[model samples]
Target: MAVHTLSRRQIFGYGTAGAAALMLGTGAWSTDSAFAAPVLTGNPFSLGVASGDPLPDGVVLWTRLAPDPFAEDGKGGMPATPVRVQYEVAEDERFRHVVRRGSVIATPELAHSVHPEIHGLRPDRVYFYRFRAAGHLSPTGRTRTTPAAGSDPRELTFAFASCQAWQDGYYTAYEHMAAEDLDLVVHLGDYLYEYGVKTNKRGVTTDPKFHTETVGLARYRLQYGLYKAEAPLQQAHANFPWIMTFDDHEVENNWADEISENNESPETFMLRRAAGFQALYEHAPLRRTQLPKGPDVQMYRRLSYGRLADFTMLDTRQYRDDQPCGDGASANCAERLDPDRTLLGARQRDWVLKGFSRSPARWQILGNQAPMGQTDQDPGADTLVWLDPWDGYVAERNRLLAEAGTRGVRNLVVVTGDRHQNYAWDLKRDYADPGSPTVGSEFVGTSVTSGGDGADMTPQGEQFLAANPHMRFFNSQRGYVRVRVDRDRWTSDFRVLPYVTRPGAPVSTRASVVVEDGVPGVQV
Candidate 1:
């Protein structure tokens, strides 16, 4: 492929009416004045542009025609009719070297959102893209395709973050994340909170429109609009390609497979779940394969960065068995020992294990929602553990850890979210045995803004570290984790922000740890 240059100011005469006229194959606009479409008035790209699910030769570009994102009808301020939107991909930020150009239809049925999958591009290269519609040019977004399959890549730099509650505090962490020199961003889960906000600890006023918990499609769409409308969050999405998954809060709190936290009827809860899944699909830069089918969406998928890393993203909430021992922190009981209990359903477990057995990448990274390490809340004679995490599904955890050892995976790293604090642990084959083999390492990232202005440490944090011998480091703060992976070593920096209740919080490294290629533990 040869590089070509065009004027940055070059504007094509392509418009929605022109495209519609051409589609009719009769030049309808040129012949009939009465059939002319009305002119659009405002900027429709209020929610900004994003790209995700990047392959070696392709990437998905996303944008919504939301002139008014907070519209009560959840139509994104788009008319009832479908509209044509044009997009372009270029090798230069100035868009002077255009590589690919195409158009997609945005319909009201999907809230005028469009996800255009662009392909036929060179591998392991950075590209710039933008959307054009209604004579308005959207903010240019930068995306990069992964290296060719089975090709050896020297390095992979990425960040993983989660749990950004819009009303909790300012999105200062995302502001810093947007400035990082990273290839991709992996959002483990909790992209949006479903709970209503009346008042926050910061004394910030809540939007009345989102003052109620999101229940159906319209409310979920409104919540997404409210979050995506944030400048810092929008900047983060525009700066880099993101790989995202969902947790319970995206639909409701602590919702497992077919059971609701509030014990709502299955039929009623399924309707809410379906709406939440649909809204998530419509707002994010996901591919067609992830489209919602009723209450379920295919989320667990694999992404390869050449021979350097393989990211196996998991969906823990969708297929998980209900929390054993009646949920929350509790003492070990017989029900918790059920071998049939599962976190990842049988199919997903088989898929992940198979990937582990056959993966050729140097680093086998599990992008998961919950922490895999056993977190003992109380360490005395009466030990108490949180059942929502791996502690709840011990049998499955042991099986997966044993499988990793049996398969002889070179470097198994589990990057997780959902926990509001940062944790670095040495994953053991058996949590009950201190002498068990350390099969892998886990990095649990802190929240973006979920837990207001967190401190360096808390009493619970001290108890947690004192109780779990496998846990190496712990920090109660608001931020994300920056990771750099290479053939020889993997380094993670626990990036933290001082205060999220106020704006302009400076981000700093709270802790740094590195694991060598053959090492299964972290060196602080």
Candidate 2:
């Protein structure tokens, strides 16, 4: 693939009078007419448009010019030259009140993707945006900015979800999520599974284009293109701005730190990881600061919604120690009890601790990828636990919980997604001590389409709650979690879908619970 670098003068020229003329004129670039272009054929906006990472003064708008998204070489059917794309941010959906309009060059170096960071807008308000490239008009997306810093907002509403495997099932949950009135959507990792497509129990056939596992940059880009091409998933992206972080499956299964599950050399694995991180940046609506540097991408950051809620999104997979005492479930493993082991490297741990000590929001939320509560798979004298989760990093988990209590962080809540199961837990300072005080609460959402049509409840799921007293509720269905936070209380509804093996599945709430401001446990 060819890469074209942009000059400073060319970039400045595109952002000025040239962009304004395209937005205000009825020429070849008009949205009302279709003019033929030599470089692009058909519709260049087939991949759709999205906006994410909202801030108090601005938001990020994203789109890619892909006439044929599944091009084998991963150029997305774009030419070698950089294309100038125009974007508009309007106060209304009909473009009558256009607030900001600019143009940016989508170069081959970044897969022809454009992320225009629009600024100087009113806070705590909604805005509509769209893109125009090569005479094709993209879908209009709506986004909202947070209230100004130190300002007290009345309420905040959003949804958090994860784990959407395309071959296993359809994305029916996102269809329902698109219809809900939410301020933002938080995706807690597993955005695109790296494994090759295979037949599942539902008898669905794998797509021929994605039958091979993703290895290089081209394959990774193709995987994301395939997932984003779904209409329901595209609808969800168009409806609300999203905040996202990654888990293990984005690159490979159960990868931790520099260790791959297949035990490849560190040099070989880092190349694969670089590909994954680069594709994630190219496709997602993330800011330019998150651009990948070699094999590392800085993902953990804080976002505040005025004084109502503060979100600390974590990157649990990047700096974690390898799973202790082998990979799978085991009984009474001594390696897991190592005090020096860490999940969030020392620097990130200190960052999170300082966030807790200095936050001013009414609700301090942690958008984590894995479950923070202890979960035992077997209930016998010798308990068995999954080494991939917090059960393996007991010392770090206890240290974080103790710090939260010492700092007096009020209304601390954690929202997680990884295990394809919904759970509500009263987070204890010490899980080994039954009489320990509950320090906070955790709401773990199920998957979007992973695991393929799970039941309402399973026999094993019932045993989980019986063994762990802190676990209050459990459901093994596919859906997302809807959360609403006010000054006095916070509520979460465990939304569930009936089936995902086929299309057109209706969603319903399986359970709902609330946590008072001063209380640390869940109320049914």
Model 1 lDDT vs. the true structure? 0.86
Residue 235 shift from truth in candidate 2, angstroms: 0.9
Residue range 453-518, candidate 1, lDDT tens digits:
999999999998888888899999999999999999999999999899989999999999888998
Question: Could you list the CA RMSD of all candidates, in the order they appear?
Answer: 8.9, 6.3
lDDT of 2: 0.85
Q: TM-scores of the models, in the given order?
A: 0.92, 0.92
Clashing pairs in 2: none
Q: After superposition, how far is residue 500 of candidate 1 from its true place, in Å?
A: 0.3
Candidate 2 per-residue lDDT over residues 1-524, each given as its tens digit: 11225332332234545443322221123243333343677678878889888999988888877888888778789886667788999999999999999777676666778778878989989999999888778999999998999999988999999999987788999999999999999999999999777655446665676788998888898888888889988889999999988998888989987788999877667778878887887788887667666567899999999988999999898899999987787777888878998999999999999999899888889999989998977666556788898888889999998899898798889999999999999988888787989999999999998998999889989889777878889999999999989999899999999899988989999999899998998887
C-alpha lDDT (0 to 100) for residue 465 of candidate 1? 85
Q: Which stretches of candidate 1 lie over 4 Å from their true place?
A: 1-38
Question: Using alpha carbons, what is the TM-score of model 2?
Answer: 0.92
